[model samples]
Target chain A: MTEAHSQRPGVEIEFRSVTKTYPGQDTPAIDNLSLTVPAGDICCLVGPSGGGKTTAMKLVNRLIDFNEGEILIGGSGVRDVDITALRRDIGYVIQQVGLFPHMTIEANIGVVPRLLGWSADRIKARAVELLDLVRLDQNFAKRYPSQLSGGQQQRVGLARALAVDPPVMLMDEPFGALDPITRNEIQDEFLKLQNEIAKTVIFVTHDIDEAIKMGDRIAVLRQGGVLAQYGTADELLGSPADEYVADFVGADRGLKRLSLRLMRDLVKVSGENHAAPADAPTVKGSATLRTGLSVLFASGSRVLKVTHDDDSATVIGTVTLDQLQDAVYETAPKAPTDVVVAGEA
Target chain B: MSFPTQVIPNFSGPNCAGQFFCWDWVGANWFSVLQPALIQHIWISALAVLFGLVISIAAALYAVRNSWFEKGFSALATFLYTVPALAFFLLMVPITGLNVGTVLIGLTGYTLLLLFANTVTGLRAAPPETIAAADGMGLTRNQVLFKVQLPLALPSIMAGIRIAVVTVISLETVAAQVVQAGLGTPLFNAQRNVFTTGLITTGLLAIALALVADALVVQLQKLVTPWVQARR
Candidate 1:
C-alpha cells in the first residue's frame, strides 16, 4: 500500500513530537504535537484563541521554530532546508492580507518568483495566471494595494501565495477579516481553487462552521497548545474525544454532524417496513440532511426517498426519524448490506 | 496769566531720508556684497542638511527596532548638542583654525541635535500594524526598514531635516564670527565702520536667505510626503 501510494506524487506534511515554548512561559505554546496531513485535502486546525492552531500552521513553513521536534514536508525535515527556499516552495496566506502598499498587485504576486530569479516575462505571465486563478481581472494587476477593498486585497494575497505554484499551502484565517458575505464568497472560491489544484493545505480558523465546511480532517486545539482532538470531521462530531473537545465543538454538535454525517450513515428505517413506495420522497446522495430535511419538508412526505445523482435519482429506500435516532445511537440491527448503495438514494 | 513756556525735547527727530541711512547702498551692493556669501551660505547649509539627513535616517533605521542602538545613538547625539557652539569652534580653531572646516564642524554638530531626534521620532511615528503587515508578507528586516518604515517615517524625518536646516543656517552665522567670513563677518565689518546703512542691508540679506531656505525645505517636504498630502 505504501509503495502503491508512493508511485504517485503527493505532498504529506507531518509534525513529529514537536514542542515549542517561549522563554519565561509556564507552558509550551505547542506541546508534543504530532499530526499528519495527507496530500490533496484541507486539514483545518480549529480552536479558541491561543490554542496553538496558528503556531502549528507557522511551524509547517518554519516561521516559528519547533524546539523539540521535526516537521516534515513530503517526508523531509524542514530544518534541513533553507528557510527562504522552503518558504518559496510553500504557499502562505495570512488573515491581514499583507499586501505591499508600495507595489502593484502584479509585483506583489511576482515577489517569490522574482526572488527565485524567474524571467520577467515568465513572472508577469505567472502573475496574470494567478490573478485569474483567484478570480481577479488582469486589469487590476497594475493597481496598488490601496486601490483595493479588503476582500480584493485578500484575493491578491491568495494570488501572491499561489504565485510560485507550491504543492503545500498554509492559511492563517485567510477569510477571517472579511465580512460574512464576502468571507463565504472567498471561502467558496478558495475551495473551488483548491479542488482544481489539489494542494495539501493546513488551514487555521477560530470558526467551527468554516472548519466543518472546509476540512477533510479537523484538529481541535485547546489552550496551552494541546491537541484536544484530531480526526475526521464526522469522527470528532459524532464522537468527541473528551469534554474539552465537546465544549470546544460547542452545544450544536448534532447540527455540525448534519454536515459531517453522510446521508447513508444517518439514514435508517424500521425493520418491519418490507413494502415501500416506488416514488417516495428522496434526497440526492450528495445532499446534506439540512438539505434533506428541506426536501422532506417541501415534499410533505415523512418518508424521504433518497436518490443518487449518478444513479439516475432512483428511489433506493425510505428513511424516517426513528431510524435516524437509531442510526445515531447505532442501536439498530444492521440492515441488509445490498439494501442501500453508496452514493445512491 | 503767565504760562511758563516748557521746552520739550524733540525726541522724534526730523525724518532725514538719505542723510545717515542711504537706501541706495542696499540696491548697489545687493548682488556684490550679499549675493556670494548668501549663495555659499545656502550651499553650505544645504550640504550640511543633506549630510545630517542621511546620517539621521541611517541611524534611525538601525535604532527603531533595536532599543539599545536607539538609546546609544540618541545619548551620543545629545552629548554632542550640549557642547556650546562658541566653545566648540574655539576648541576646533587650534586644530583647523579660522576656515570653513571650523564652521562646517560646528554646524554639523548642531545639525545632529535636530536630525537625531527627528529620525528617532519619525521611525516611532510609523504604525505598528505597518511593521506587522510587512513581516507577515515575509519581507526581510532590511526590506521592512527601507520600503515600509522609511517611507512612512518620511514626514517626521523631513520635519526634523527642516528644523536642522534652519538651526544650522542660523548657527553658520555664529561660526562665521570665528571663521572670519560669511554674513556674520560682513555685519561685524559694517559695525567696525559704524555704517548703519551697510548693517541694515546685510542684516536684511541674512534674514532673507534664512526665509528662502526654509520655504524651499517645505516645498521639498510636500513633494516627498504624498500620503500626508492626501490627508490634508
Candidate 2:
C-alpha cells in the first residue's frame, strides 16, 4: 500500500474528457465523460441502460481503460499508479454481490487487506469491525457466503470493498440484486452508514429514484453517452438543464424532491405547531414531505398530524398540503448548477 | 467369452488340482509369481496415471486460453479415448519396441481423456463473477486462477483423477501382452494352458486392485475437497 492510499480520508476522483471506445466499434462506450466527485461525497450517475454510467465508474479504477483524456484519483493519474495497488485502494461493489463462494465471510471481507499483506490478526480484527459496521452478527464471520440471503451477501460484498478502508468507492447497482423489500431496507441502512464513513463514492444505477435517494449530487446522463446535467438532486428537480433532463427526472420531479426532505426537518424549520390536534390524520415524523402530502390528500383533512420518529405518542407537528407545496416552490433553481466538465467537440 | 476359462488346473500334469481356483497352486505361487505381478501392476498404473495427470493439467490450462486449441484438443482427447487398449498396445509396439516403455505409453495415453476433461471443466467451474470480483479486488490473472479458480475446481479435478486411476489399472492388464508386465502376463500364461486357477486368480486380483485404487483416490478427493463434503 502506498503512503497516499493508507490515509483514512477519502480523496477526490476526477474524470477529465475521458472517452472509451471499444475495439471494432466506431462509437465510444463512454464519450468524453467528465465529472469531479469531491472527497466525502456520494455522486450518483443515473441514465438509460446504454448511457455508460457503469463504464464511467469503472474508468476511475482503470477496470475499463479510456482512450482519450485522463482519470485522476486524489491528483495523480490512475495510469501512473500500479493497477493492482490502485484498485486495492478504491473500493468496488457490483450488483451481483460477488462474494467468493469458497471463502468464509471473514476471509471474503479481508481479501484486499490480505492482498496488501496485512498480518492475520489485523485482517481478522478489521473483519470484525466491518461486520459490526455493516450490521451483520458477529457469528456470521465464520459462515460461508452460501448461507447468507441476497441482502446479507450484498452487505458482505460491501464489507469486502471497505476492507482496505479505501478512500473512493465505485458501486454499480450494489443493491440491485435484492428484492424490493430487502433493497429498501439495505438502501436505508447504507445511507445511514454512508453518513458515518463519508467516503467519496461514484454510484451507478439506472433507477432515477435510487439516484435521488442516495446521491448528494446526481449526474443525469442521456443516450449516446452524453451528460445532460450534473448537479444536486434539488437542482435537477428544481431547474432541469434542458427538456431531456426535465423529462429524465420525470413529470413527478416536484414530488421526488419532497421525498428528499423529512417532515421533521420541515416541522423543525417552518416553526410549525408541535403535537397538533388529535383529530388530524397522523403521519410519522420520519415520513418525507411527499408522504405527508399523500396523507393530507388521503385523509381529506385541512392538515395532518406528524408523530415523533421514536415515540409515536408524542406528536411532532402538523403539516398542510399548502405548506408542502410552498416547500417545493422554495427549491426552485436559483442559479445554474450544471457544471459539465466536457472539453470535447 | 464372458467367463474366464483359463483358470482350470492342468489336472493331467503332476500336482495339478482338478478344480477351479486351486488354492494349492496359489499358496505355492503367491510369493514367486502372483505377488510380483500384482505389485508390478500397481506400479505401472501409478506411474501411468501420474504422467497422465501432469500432461492433462498443462494441456487443460492451455486449452482454456485458446478456443481453437480447446476445439482441437477436445477432438484429440476423444480420438485418444476411442483407441482400444489392445490396438493402442499394437500401435506402440513398432515405435517403442517390446520395452516396458511401450506398455507405459499405451497405459498413460488411455488416461489422458478422462484427466484432461476433468481438469479443464474443473478450472472453468469457478463462477465468472467471483473471478471478476477477485480481479476488481486487485488480484492478478494468475493469482485469481491459482487461488480462487483452482480451489473451487478441486472437486471436479479430483473426481477426474479417481476415474483415471481405476481406468489405468484395468488398461495395465492389456499392457501385459505388450511387455509381459503386471497381472496380464500370468493371465496370458493361464490362457495358453487353459488353467482356470491362474486365470481366475489373476483376473480377481486385477479387479481387487482396481477397487482398492478407486477407493484410495476417492479418499484423497474427499481430503482435498472437504468443502464439497461440507456442502453435501
Query: How much is B160 displaced in model 2, in angstroms?
Result: 2.0
The estimated TM-scores of all candidates read 0.79, 0.89
Q: How far is each candidate from the true structure, as Cα RMSD in Å? A: 8.9, 5.7
Once model 1 is optimally superposed onto the true structure by TM-score, how far is the C-alpha of residue B72 displaced, in angstroms?
A: 3.3
lDDT for each candidate structure: 0.73, 0.82
**What does the lDDT read for residue A319 in candidate 1?**
69
Model 2 chain B: ten consecutive residues of lowest lDDT: B1-10
In Å, residue A199's CA in model 2 sits off its true spot by 1.4
Candidate 2 is scored at a TM of 0.89
Q: Which residue segments of model 1 deviate by more than 4 Å?
A: A1-10, A24-26, A137-139, A260-287, A294-345, B1-23, B64-69, B82-87, B124-140, B187-215, B218-232
Tens digit per residue, CA lDDT, model 1, B1-232: 2222221111112232445676545444555556777777877788777777778777877787789998898887887789888788888999987788677767777777688787778767666645654554456778677777677677877888778877887777777667866777667666776767667767777788878878988999888864454310
Candidate 2 regions exceeding 4 Å error are A1-7, A272-278, A307-317, A331-345, B1-16, B67-79, B91-97
For residues B1-232, could you state the per-residue lDDT of candidate 2 as single tens digits? 1322243332232265578667767766776678999998888899999999888888888887888888888788789889888988988899889988888888778888888889889999898888878888889888887788878888888888888988888888877776889999988888887989889999999999999989998899878875565431
In each prediction, how many residue pairs overlap at the backbone (N, C-alpha, C within less than 3 A)? 5, 7
Give each prediction's DockQ, rounded to 2 decimals: 0.12, 0.49
Worst 10 residues of 1 chain B by lDDT: B3-12
